[model samples]
Target: MSSPKSGGAGWLVLLALLVLVLAVASVLVGASDVSMLALLGIGGAPADPMASQLLFASRVPRTVALILSGMAMAVAGMIMQMLARNRFVEPSTAGTVESASLGVLAVALFAPELPLFGKMVVSAGFALAGSLLFLAILRRIPQRSSLIVPLVGLVLGGVISAVTTFFAHRHDMLQSLHAWSTGDFSAVLRGRYELLWIGFGLTLLAWHTAHRFTVAGMGRDFSANLGLRHGRMVALGLLIVATVTAVVVVTSGMVPFLGLIVPNLVSLMLGDNVRRAVPWVGLLGAAFVLACDIAGRLLLHPYEVPIGTVVGIVGSALFLFLLLRTRARVG
Candidate 1:
């Protein structure tokens, strides 16, 4: 049998190859027919200027958004799970995404002239506040069953979502907010998706602080015993999670369980050592979302399904499986 380290390295390589394949396939599979041979110069340039334009402008940006958004949300989920000590907790469940959506709606209604960057900043700020609020609530709750934490988060998130919806309706921006909240890459283009690079940067920051997060995951007393500043680490982790969540939500909208499912799946296969698992989580997250997006594009041929819808269907099933598996272990 392969050693754990070797096995992880093997999976990393395999996942990297898979991501590359999917990325290329994503570029090729679109409304316009841009063949691999043409892209490779084997058959010269694309048949039409429109094909080249579409390839460079639409497909490439959309693919990059998928990769960045997937990896960021997955890493953000891992950070949240570590901090909450609950496998089911993630940005979507914990009110972060809903808060960001509210921020966007507020900006659209109150400050209609705000630029895209300004809107993103406002959304990220709200996300940070919402995440901090969730953490405070978690701190107040007495240690109980593991399931309680996520339940509370879900309730909190639902409340936030309702508030957002109410305001959106009042402002006559319900359809706009709904479109922004539903994850889809069909509208992605060169200028629109540049914000997601912030998520990429934050993901790298998360990796750098992986060991700190692992220490922080062991609860306050354990982190303190080792001379770690427990509060500071948790703050930093939440900042990373909030920033990534906001950026992804602002750019690509919500991709449901990209975070919740990816990190748990990575932990189930690889050990839960944050440092060891984070890179794999990122790679697998990107690949999984890319696969889902491709499936969404092809599922209805001319009419594409939203990536969020595809992920929601698959993620809900995986979440149920994880819940049952955890219950069995506890029993």
Candidate 2:
């Protein structure tokens, strides 16, 4: 009999290969005429100058951003679920994304020419505060049911979003705010998406500390009994989540239902073992975004539908299915 570990490794290899294929497809499917043959210079056909231009300047960067942001959000979400001890909680739902968006809006207003790194710092600070606020609210609640927890997060997110919108409208930055809040990859260019690399690095840190996060997920008392610094671990997890949230929002805007649904779906497949599931989460997340992006490109023909809308439609439906299924399991 094969060990589950070995079996999982096999599946992991397969998933990685699948994600590679999806990445190639992402590079090929675009408004421009970039094709596999052109990329390969196959059949002695010279690469079209336009194809090369589109491939390097646009498609490659966009695809890289998608993978990095996808992995970051999914891994960050998993860390969050572990810390919250709730499957449904993620950065967006917990008000972290809104806070980061607010931070971006602040930068746009106060420091219009702030470097990307500077924006990341400010946004991360706000996202960390939002995450802490959510955790504080969770502590005060007497009932911490799975459904109830996410509902509270949703409420908190709504409040933050409302404030952000109000300030944005007042300052005439609503259009820019919308661009920052909606996950659209159309504008991603080579230099623009480097911020997501920082997010991806933080994601690697989360993977390195996965076991600690697993312990942190079991509540303070349990983690304390195991000789873990529960509070510190929680802080680290929140920092990782916040930084990644800021990075993605700053680079490509908020991709809703991504952090919430990807981790939940991965949990169903791999159980709650953060260490083991981290790679799978990243791979699945990239594939999820790639597929959605491809569909968005095709759905509207040359026009493109925005990855956020496509993922929102699909992820929300899956979320509802998971909710009902979990409810059934509980019943």
Candidate 3:
């Protein structure tokens, strides 16, 4: 009963509404209260100079990083899902976060004076290695069951995280690794978050190469039949996912479910067709991050919970509910 034009229009309208909400929420949120009217430049000067500075220096960068990191993770999730042929294969779920965090801890502990870019490069290398390890494991374990794949990934991530935690504890760097592992956005001041630009670039590259990704996802035999080099596509996808995860981990810490949840939501709405889903996945990711960041900023008012905390709590609940509901429907 609905034409494609009508459906697209409806989605656009809903997306526009969400965008407005996120914009208002982002501008009006922080540890210090900034009124909507004042934020829109329709009121007197803010009462506190530090508060204004915090909004400018801290909140803006965090918001920008949130947007960039969310899109990057979401796209990474999509690419991983396509390559692994599993809905739940995300960087966080697949040991990328733990491996990157370990890399960061190594830098913080032993090479403390290394530049930020150097840290990102090291973290990205480890993340790429972790993902490749996961892919190798996937090949070794037959994928006759869909549920087993993500379960293996989750176990692998758990093992890596345990190792990282042990190292952190041994070096008395537990607090530092804990802070980095929790996906906190509170510390993202202007100079601190330029690393997230790497994520932005990776997301853009994903968008540009989306069509090839679709072909690549159709299994090696089918892609080769169509004259596409499956190996090249797989390599490119892993590189994109790894670079984005490293930048996000360094900039915003370890956000768990953004990558896993956003792509599935988009594919549900837009079908399995990767090209149509890519843009919507990005928009949804940005919106979700903005909304969660705003909620974290506002939930405690003067004492904000970290964006990572808010996302983890809310995102885990959402993912579990969706999983149960899907099971129920299937049953």
Candidate 4:
């Protein structure tokens, strides 16, 4: 049998190839008929001008958004896992995405004229704050059981989401909040997606702190022994998670299970080494979202299902299965 390390390396390679294939497939699977033949300059005549424009204008942005958001959420999950020391921790689980959505709702209600960038900043700030709050609560709780930590975060997130829903309802902005909660890439366009560059920057920040995080995850005493500031590294990780959550929420909405799903899969196949794990997490995340987006577009042709719906169905099922499996193991 192959060793786990070799298996992980092989899986990472497979996931990378899958990501590339799915990304190209996504770019080709929209409403307009743009054959792979035409795309390849093979034997087909050029598609209609409007179709071509639609392909470039809408499909490209949507696909790019998928890849970026996927990478961001997956990395955010990895960061959360390292900081919280729990396998189940995710941006959504920790309330970052919901908090950002709440901020977006507030902006829409009070500052209707605010530019998208302005709105994104507000949401990003709140998302980061929410993540920090979860971290703080995490620290306060006794570390007797790592499992309980994520449960606390989930409860806290639920409370915040309830508060957000209450305010949105009172302000008659529930619909707006609802729209943003369900991950949808249909609205992405070129100018609209420039904000995602922030996610790229945050990813770089995560990369820079990767080593510090691995040390921090070893425990406060251990990290301090190594002369690392555990609190600062945790704070930095939360910031990256929050910023990435905000970008994804504003760009493609919630995208359930990405944070929980990608990192776990990567870690399972690759083992717990953060540095080695990150690339596979990102590629698989990107590929998973891209594949889901394509399936959403084609499954209900002429009436595209939202990417969010597809992911929700698949992710929720997978999440529950993972949860049960974990519970069984723990039991």
Candidate 5:
């Protein structure tokens, strides 16, 4: 049998390959027949001008958004899990998504003409506040049981989501809220997805802080004993998670399971060395989201299923399995 270290390296390589394949497949699978052969110069120019236009204008942006958003959300999930010391905690569960949604709605209602960048800033601020609130609640809770943290987060998220919904209905912007909350990359065009690149930067920041986050995960007393500033690390980790979640929710809507499922899956395969696991988390995140986006594009053919819906289905199933397995172990 391969040693665990070698196995992890092998898995990382496999995940990188899969991400590359899926990226190409995503670029090639759109409605217009953009000949990959032509793009590669293996054949004559694309027969239709629209083909090149579609490829560069729409397909490229959408694919880039997928990769960036996927990696960002996965990394965010990893950070949240580490900080909370709970496998099931994610942005959606922790109220960050709902908080961002509320921010977007607030922008639309009060300053309908606000630029997209302005909207993103507002949303990110709200997400940071909501995440801090979740963290505060976690601090008060006894950590005797791992599941209680996520359960509390879920309840908090639900309450926030309900409040957003109520205000959206009152303001007669429920449809707009729904559209922004649903994750779909079909509408991503050249300029619309540039915000997601900010997410890419945040993911890199997470990588730099990975060691601090891992130490912070060992509980406050332990981290403090090791001469680490536990509170500062936790604050930084939550900021990364909130910012990433806000950008993604603003750009592509709430991709529910990408964050929650990918990091946990990576942790199961590889051990909890955050520095080492970050790369695998990022690669698997990109591959998983790309795969879901491709499936969404093809599943209905002429009409596309939203990427959020596709991921929600798969993520929910995997989540259930994880819960059951955890329960069995506990029992």
Candidate 6:
């Protein structure tokens, strides 16, 4: 039998291949018929020039956005889990996304001409504040049970979301707000999705600091005794989460439950060592979101279902399963 290390390596390789295949599918499975044969120059060249234009201008950018946002959200969730010391809490559950949306709405209402980058900065600030508020709430809770933390986060997120919805409704920007709230890649093009690359860079930074986060995930006293600054680590983790959540929200809309589901799944399989788990988390995240995107494209051919809808179905189901399983384990 193959050794465990070899088996793990094999799985990682398989996952990387899966992501590549899904990325290709994403690039090719759009409305325009851009054949692999044409791109490969298999048949001399694509007869239609529009195929090339559409591939570069639309499909490629969308696929890049998909992979970047997927990996970033997954990694962000993993970091948040470490800082929050709770498996279930993520940007979505902890009010980060709603806060980011609130920021975007503020920009829209007040500074209609603000650039996308400026909007992302404002969104990130709100997300950071929301995350800090969540941490503060966690500190006040008398009983910090495994499930209680995420319940608190969900309540906070819902309250923020409700506030956002009311304002959107009042301003007659309900349609725009809904669009920003839903994760849809249909509108992502070259220039539009460049911001997601920053999120990807932040994800990489998280990976680089994975050891510190792992240390911090232990109780604060333990981490302090070990010469690790738990507070600083947590602040960094939350900043990464806030920036990544904002970047994804501003660039591709909110992908509900992804940050909640993906990290938990990876943690179950790989354990909580951030350095060891980061790669698996990122790969699985990209694969999960990319597969969902492909399914959305094919499920109703020519008319794509939004990725948020698809991910919501899958992520929510998985989340419920986790909750039941956690309850069973605790019981």
Which structure is stronger by TM-score: 4 or 6? 6
Over 4-48, each residue of candidate 6 has an lDDT whose tens digit, in order, gives 233377778888999999999998897678896765566676467
**TM-scores for every candidate against the unseen true structure:** 0.95, 0.95, 0.91, 0.91, 0.94, 0.95
Cα deviation of 115, candidate 6, in Å:
1.0
Steric clash pairs (candidate 5)? none
Q: What lDDT is obtained when candidate 2 is compared to the true structure?
A: 0.88
lDDT tens digits by residue: candidate 1, 184-286: 8999999999999988998999999899998999989999999999999999988888888878877878888778999998787776778888889899899
Q: What are the RMSDs of all candidates, in order?
A: 1.9, 1.9, 2.7, 2.4, 2.1, 1.8
Please, what is the whole-model Cα lDDT of each candidate in the order they appear?
0.87, 0.88, 0.81, 0.81, 0.87, 0.88
Model 3, 217-326: lDDT tens digits are 88899999999999999999998888888888887788888888888887777678777777678778888888887887777787778878888887788778766766
Q: For residues 54-129, what per-residue lDDT tens digits would candidate 4 score against the true structure?
A: 7778878877888888888888898888887888888878878778988888888889899888888889899988
Residue runs of model 5 more than 4 Å from their true location after superposition: 1-10, 37-46
Clashing pairs in 4: none
What lDDT tens digits, residue by residue, belong to model 5 across residues 1-331? Answer: 3554544466667778889899999999967787756455456644666777889999989999999999999999999999888898899888899899989988988998999899999999999999999988878886447667778888998999999999999988888888878899988999999998888998999999899898999998999899999989988888888888888888889999677889888777777778888888898899999999999989988679999999999998998888888989999
What is candidate 3's CA lDDT for residue 99? Answer: 84
CA displacement after TM-score superposition, residue 208 of candidate 3 (Å):
1.5
Q: By how many angstroms RMSD does model 4 differ from the true structure? A: 2.4
The predicted structure with the larger lDDT, 2 or 3, is 2
Mind giving the per-residue lDDT tens digits that candidate 2 earns over 1-331? Answer: 4343443687888888988999999988876788867766788988677788888999999999999999999999888888888888888778899999989888888998999999999999999999999999999999677888888988999999999999999998889988998899999998999989888889889889999899888888999999999999989999999999999998888898898898777777777677888888888999999999999999988999989889889988987888788889999
Q: State model 6's lDDT.
A: 0.88
lDDT of 3: 0.81
